[model samples]
Structure formats: C-alpha cells, structure tokens
Target: MSVFETGQTVVRRDVHRSGRVWSEQALRVVADTSEVLVAACVHGAEARWPALYAKARDDGDRSVRTEAFEAMAAGEWELAAAVWQETDLLLWKPPATWFSVNAFFVPEGDGRRLRNWYVNFEHPAHRTEAGFDTFDLTVDLVVTPDLTRWEWKDEDDYAHVRRLGIVSDTEPGPWTPPATRCWR
Candidate 1:
C-alpha cells in the first residue's frame, strides 16, 4: 500500500532558519544573470543591509560574529545611510561588497494600480564571515499592496519607484509578473 506511507510529513527547521531559504534563491540568480546585471542588482538592494548586518553581528559563528562587528564598525556606505538611521538597525560599518533587491509586481487596469513588492539583500562572502566568495542574499516582500516605498532619501536605485512609491510605479510599468501557482 504505497510502501506503507505514513500520511505525515517531516520538516527541517534549519531550511527556513539560518538564512538558507533566501540565500539559496539569491545564489541561483547570481548564477543565471550576466556579469553586468549583477552589479546593478547590488545597487538596487543596498537599503536592507542594516537589518542583515544586525543579524550577522549576532551570528552564532565566532568568526562570523567577529567579521560582522568589524564590518559594522567601519561605517562605509557608498550610498546614503539615511534608511539605516530610520530603521535604527546597524550591523557593519562598511562591507567590501554588497547585494541589492529586485521585486516583482503585477500591473493593474488603466495602467495604474497598486501591487505588492519585495526587496532582496545580501552581504559578500568573506573568510571571516563564513569563508566563501559569493553574494549572501535575502529577500523581503511586502505583505500588502498599500505598503509605501521607503529608503534612505538619496540612496535609491530607481528614480521612478522612489518618487512614485513602489506600488505606484509597479502598477504602470513593463513588469507584469504572473500570479504564483505554487511556492518555488
């Protein structure tokens, strides 16, 4: 009878925790895109590093913790640091490299409507912070469409989205992401 199936499931907590979920998606995109786009992505996702850095600073790995502290202390953001001030979450001073976010939004009729958006983030892989060489990315999606766009005033990658707000821009744009049928 179906090899004695148990009608139950087993889940690994680590899969969702430890940044594995977001990290894996980030890595896959890094592999699929051209070299030029990668840099652009880093630019787009710069705003979220504050939260990530905070998370990294408290990392369980002794080496990672050390690296996080050093990164946060240097305070060298190439872009504006205003958002971090608003969020009140700081982790690293300045990182050698960084990654940014790209979110998908569906368009509405009249070419004007609100849509949900998400942000992705990543810190470069460094020996002190887990000993690797790649983008450690994470994605942050808005739960609702009314969510207004926010960022460190001068540090935005998109002139349109920053001014119109994510939903406003997303509604009347080339992007027309299809509805998800299932979780990837």
Candidate 2:
C-alpha cells in the first residue's frame, strides 16, 4: 500500500532540494500513490552560504558566488560574511491549481530573532516523474513573521518580466492570510 493517500494531510520528512528526509513538517497531500507523493505547506531550512558557494564553484549559476567574492575583494566583508553564517527557513506551499507561496525566514544576529520574512508568490508547481518545478511570478510580498509591517519586493523586476511577456499579473491574495494565521 502507499504511505500517503490523496487529499490526506501529512508531514514531509524529506528535503525538497536534496531529496533527503532531514526534517518533517505538516503538509496536505495533493496527490499520493505508489509512484509519487505531492504535498503542500512543507517547510524547511536551506544552508545559505555553503549551497551558494558550491553552486558557484560547481553549478552553472555563478552569480551568487561571484557577488560574494566581488564584495569580499572590494573590502565590503559584511556582505560576503553573512552569506557564510546565516541560514534561511523556507515555508513553502505547492499550489493545488492557482499559485504557490514561499515564505523565507532570514536569521538575525546579536541575540535578536526579529529577522526578515520574504514571501515569494509564484506559479503553481508542475510535478514530474523526477520532482516538482515552479517559476517565479516576479512580484513578492515582504513582511515580518508577526505581520505588523509589510512591503513589496522586486517590483521593478516584476514589471520588466511582465513587459517581456514572461509572466502575467496574478494576485496571490488567497495564500497569505492562512500563512499569517498559522505563523501567529
């Protein structure tokens, strides 16, 4: 029998990026069977600097490491320094049909945990035999975990992409409220 059933609420005990069960979090099973298990609201932390450095050194994406190295060479050590120490927890919900939400938890030093929450609104995930994939929608909402303050991130980039016909303006209004409620 399959471990999970369709429409069942379960916790993901695996890392989405690495496909290793490093931790677990409550999620709703959108589709589950012997072949594959697709879920929503799975959350986990990603090692920031190490992954970036590795990607830059090994993977095709060199921008992250390049920026860090350039910053370090220019004597702007702070920019590159934090990229090595800080981690980010991503609260992700793979959409059933409409859109997906990714809320990032950034770390703050000095014994204060009042870090930033970066919410990315994106397209609904496409699950394949290998895994899942999703594209960024350009615009994003940035808010604290407490929701006391909020703003928009990458408006210019979003507009540019829209102008290029890469993505359309779709409201991610439905996802945020529940996330805020759950975090509180």
Candidate 3:
C-alpha cells in the first residue's frame, strides 16, 4: 500500500521503473493511481479530485478527462454493431481490460504513450449528447499503438462506472447497452 505524492516518479506498479524518469511519466504514474479518480472526479485522493464528469461543474486537470472517457465507452448497445466495429482493442492486461475512444495519445518511443492528464476524457462516458439516439451504450477508451483489434477481459473491470454516478439520458448513447454488455 505505497502512496504516491504529486512529485513522485510513476511506473507501472506491475512494471518497475529505474531511478529517474520523465516528469510527465511521473505525473502520469501518480495520476493513474486509483488513489485519484483520473476519470470522473468523485474519486478520492490525499489532496483532492474534482468531478471530472461535471462538465459544467468539473474543473479538474487533463488527467481527469482521460480516465472518464475510457470508463464510459465500454457498453454502447444501440449502436454496438456500428460503433463496436470501430473500437480499438483492450489496453490493460487481465483483470483490467479498459475500453474507450481513441481520444488520442502522447508519443512514446515507437509507441503512443498517453500522458496521465489526457488519459481520461474531460467528460464522463465521452459520449456526445447525440450518441443516445443511436444506442444504449457505454464507451471504453482503448489506447494502443495499433488500433485494429477488439475483445473483452472482465465484465466488472469497468470500476470507473461505479464512481461515474448517472449519465443523463438526454446525452447521446443510452446509458446501458441493449445487451448485458457488448463485446466484438
């Protein structure tokens, strides 16, 4: 149970890093910690985490937006057939198969590494209000070097959903998919 402060270096807890690292990576590592809800800001951090989904109310930094988008994109049912057709593959390993809009990424070596700040969308579920007309959906952000795969690992890995509270029906892409959950 190690706690990460704002200034500490960030490497995967599952993957260790050397002594020194990038300031952005360090920030991202701490940003990625569940300690802070990089997605919708309802999450807890030693300092503070604002409501990332509170578009009108949320005033969090870049990281918050990125996490929210990833958590929101997983189960878009109405247009699951079409939207799922365009989704990228999962990101994390087993137990944490994350899905969401490409939402862009930060460059890292030959790969596109995401900066912690931009990992979550500034908005929750990253769905445009218009998306609702088409489907009962939940978007998952799938950031990867290659964007040509689709799959699922866990049904409950969408832990961010629990924190996101409720999405407006007025918003496009219905809250839950027509099905239990979607997979392609």
Candidate 4:
C-alpha cells in the first residue's frame, strides 16, 4: 500500500470497466492513512470530463447528460478540458468502501461556506501510482451541509446504465445499490 503525503498532487481517474479512462482530475492530498485518502481541489483545478457531460454542465441542458449516458452505454465518448469552478471540493474515500463522500464549498462573504455534501456511489478506490481509480455507478446522494435534507440523484441514469450492461453483477466487490443500503 502506497501512502501519500499531505499537499502532494495526485490524479484521480474515473475508469470505465472496458479499460479506458473516462475522466481525470488533479487533486491535492489533504490527509492519507491506511484507512482512507482525503483529497481536495480548489477553483480552477484542471480536469478532463466527458464532452457531453461538460456540455450539460455548461449549457444546463439535461438532455446532453442523457446523451452522455447513451455514449457510455456504447463505450465511446470524447473528453473535454474543464476546470473546477465556483467551489472547492474535498473528497473522502475509504479504500474498501463502495462510495466516496464529498463536500462542496462555495465562496461566501470573505471565505467559503459549505454548499452541500455529495455521496457518490461507486467502486472502491484502486490505488495507482498517480493517485487512484474508480468507476462511478451513476447514482448519488446529495445532502444539505447541515445534514438535514437529502436526496437521491440520477436514478434514471443508474437504471439506464444497468440496462445497457455498464453496471452489472460482475463488476467487483460485494457492493449493492445505495437505494438498497439506505432505504432498506
């Protein structure tokens, strides 16, 4: 097991099961231990995202995101250069867990304020030389910064990906859907 030092730069790569890179972002390590890796990215951090995902974010068009899911179903998509904007992100990933918890901070008066807590349901982290790799399973949980309200996001995409065989019974681990875990 490789250990990362605080303030060191590392690359987080989202990998498709087909042995292809889906997206990549640069993050700075905040804390590292045998249990979890904590990393963060501030505004203007460089990232590469799926073009259609980028379009959806830029244009606020939901259909573009649907198209991205379709492209993922087909295992073909283009990458676009993007920058982290408007917020600072801190991510906590336990190497053996099926999810990562993220906190997004937006600029407030003189500093930043917690915007929300985002839990991304995904494969457990696979440590790499650069940073770590994981596959996003599409569904996510969004919670208020104060932990009062929470919502599930992208159930439609999760269903779509499951139907397209992007996520199936044979990925890895004893992971189950967030819905099953949280509500049941």
Candidate 5:
C-alpha cells in the first residue's frame, strides 16, 4: 500500500466500470492514513468533467443535467476543462467504504465558513498512481453545516441511472444515513 504525503497534489478520478474516466479533479492531500485519505481543493483548482455536466452547471437546467446522466449511461461523452468554483472542498474517503463525506466551505467576511456537508454514496477508492479512483452511484446526502437539516440529493437521478444499468441493485450494501450517525 502506497501513502501520499501531506500537501501533495493528487488527481481524483471518477471512473466508469468500463474503464473510462467520467471526470477528474486535482486535490491536495490533507491527511493520509491506513484507514482513510483526506484531500482538499480550494476554488480555482483544476478539473475536467463531461461536457454535458459542465453545461448543466453553467445553465442551471435540471433537464440538461439529466441529459448528462443519459450520456453517461450510453458511455458516450466528452470532457471539458473546468475549475472548481466558489467553494473550498474537503473530501474524506475510506478505501473500503462505499461512501465518502465531503465538506464545502464558502467565503465569509474575512475567512471561509462551512457551507454544507455532502455525503456521496459510491464505490470504494482504488489507489492509483495519480491519486485514487471511484465510481459515483449518483445518490448523495446533503447536510447543513450544523448537521441539523439534511436531505437526499439526486434520488431521481439515482433511479434513472439504475434503470439505465449504470448501478446494480446489489452494488451498495445496507447503509445508515448521516442523520443517524454520531458526528460528535
């Protein structure tokens, strides 16, 4: 098992089961241990995403985003260069876990403050030379910074992906929501 040093630049790749990359983002290693890898990216970090996905972000059209998923389902898409915008991101990934916890920070008066906590249910991390790889299952949980208010994100999309055979019924095991977990 290889370990990444703190402050090292690593590329996180979202790979499809067919061995194609869906997206790639650069992150700086925050912490690395046998249990998990922690990484962070500030606004302006480099990223490459499916063109349709980038369109969805720029247009704010839900239908366009849905179209992106459709593209993914067909395994036909193009990558567009993009930059992480407006938020600082901290990602925590446990190699064998089926999910990852993410924290997004937005600028406040002089510094930044936690905007929200996001939990992405996905395949476990696979170590790579650049950084790591994982497949996003499309479903996620978004929690308020205080962890008081939370909601499921992209459930309809999850269903759509499942119907398109992007995710298998047995891919994820029984899991608990963040609300039910002990954060403190």
Candidate 6:
C-alpha cells in the first residue's frame, strides 16, 4: 500500500506575515510507493517575486541585482530569485532519520527542457491520513540538469540555528560516536 492514496488532499499550515494561523490545501497526491510519494499543488501556480529582483535576474540588470543582494544581506529572504516552479513534487525516502530529498522542477526560458533541479534535504516526513508533512532542516542543494555545477545553500543558517538551540546536534538515527582518548 502507498503512504498516501492518489487524489488525497494535503494541507500545509504555516504562519503568515500577519502572525495568524494560515492553512492551505497545498498538495494533492498523484503517485505513491514505498520509495517515494509524488504530489502536485492544487492552488494556482505562478512565479511570484519582488519586482526589482525579478528584473535583476530576468533582464540582466546589474543595478537591480546589486540592490537585491544588499536586501538579502540585510536579512530579507523574500528578495531572492524569481522562481517559476513546476507543480509536480517528488519526495524520496533514503532510509535515514530526518532525511529525505524533495525534488522540484523549474523551467528555463528557452523551451528546450526544464533546466533546474531543486533538492531539499530535511526531516523525514510524517504520513498523515490525508497526506504527509515534513519540515525543512535548513540545508539544501541545487543543481543543473547536466550536473556541471551545484550549490550548497544555507550552511551558515543551519549552524546559526543549531548554535541558538533551535535544532539538535545529536545524530538522527541510532549511530553514535566512540569515546575519544585525551592525550595531553
């Protein structure tokens, strides 16, 4: 049996900018098996972005790009790239605790093929009666379809959150380190 059945409704609850509980029927399960569960967003899919940042990336405008970088340095997350993401979702379970790879497709402009692959490694999902849910663990990897270059995003954020007692340092599974000998 699959973790979630096809056409099942999945809700994602998050805090909105107004500080209220905002819940949306985010995903509908498409395919499910022991290894992976695929879903698609039911809501209207569009590329949302800050206007200046979108101009920066899409128009090759250096001035806007500089402004966006400055805004990001000032700790604004919403000022990043204009993401035209595909609706399909792939959740892969790799037999590790608090670890799964969520993959998504982002289309590039030329109409050749979808060129961007975004993979997120985060806590293993909890399968609910409706669907499944998982929280992001901060570390993520993005790559091109040709595998020429890849970027590791948010290592500093992970370390900062860990230091602030937000996330645990303990390994997710049963494995532990052996005792170290002190040689002074």
- Give per-model TM-scores: 0.21, 0.43, 0.23, 0.90, 0.92, 0.54
Q: Write the per-residue lDDT of candidate 6 for residues 100-150, one digit (tens) a residue.
A: 445554444643354445566555656556554454455556666666776
Give per-residue CA lDDT, model 5, range 65-176, as digits (tens). Answer: 8888889888899999999999999999988999999999999999999999999998889999899999888888888998888787777777778789888878965443
Question: Model 2, 24-138: lDDT tens per residue?
Answer: 3345566655444455442242212333444555555646654533433333322111121243333444344344434443444653353566666654545543344454554
lDDT of 4 by residue, 13-93 (tens): 899988888899999999999888999999999999999999999999988998898898798899999998988999999
Model 2: weakest 10-residue lDDT segment is 76-85
Best by TM-score: 5
Positional deviation of residue 109's Cα in model 3 after best superposition, in angstroms: 8.7
Which run of 10 residues does model 6 get worst, by summed lDDT?
175-184
**Residue 178 lDDT (model 1):** 30
The residue ranges of model 1 lying beyond 4 angstroms of the native Cα positions read: 1-96, 107-117, 125-148, 151-184
Instruction: Sort by TM-score, best first.
Output: 5, 4, 6, 2, 3, 1
RMSD (CA, Å), each prediction: 17.8, 11.6, 18.5, 3.0, 3.6, 9.6
State, as a TM-score between 0 and 1, how close model 4 is to the true structure. 0.90
Tell me the lDDT of candidate 2.
Answer: 0.45
1 or 3: which has the higher TM-score?
3
Q: lDDT tens digits, residues 54-170, model 3?
A: 331245354544454443443221101111111112122111213223233444577654332112211321112211001112344332435444333222433344345423434
Report residue 125 deviation for candidate 5 (angstroms): 0.4
- Per-prediction count of colliding residue pairs? 8, 0, 38, 0, 0, 0
Candidate 3 lDDT score relative to the true structure: 0.27
Candidate 5's displacement at residue 17, Å, is 0.8
Tell me the lDDT of candidate 1: 0.28
Q: What is the lDDT of residue 183 in candidate 5?
A: 30
lDDT of 3 at 165: 43
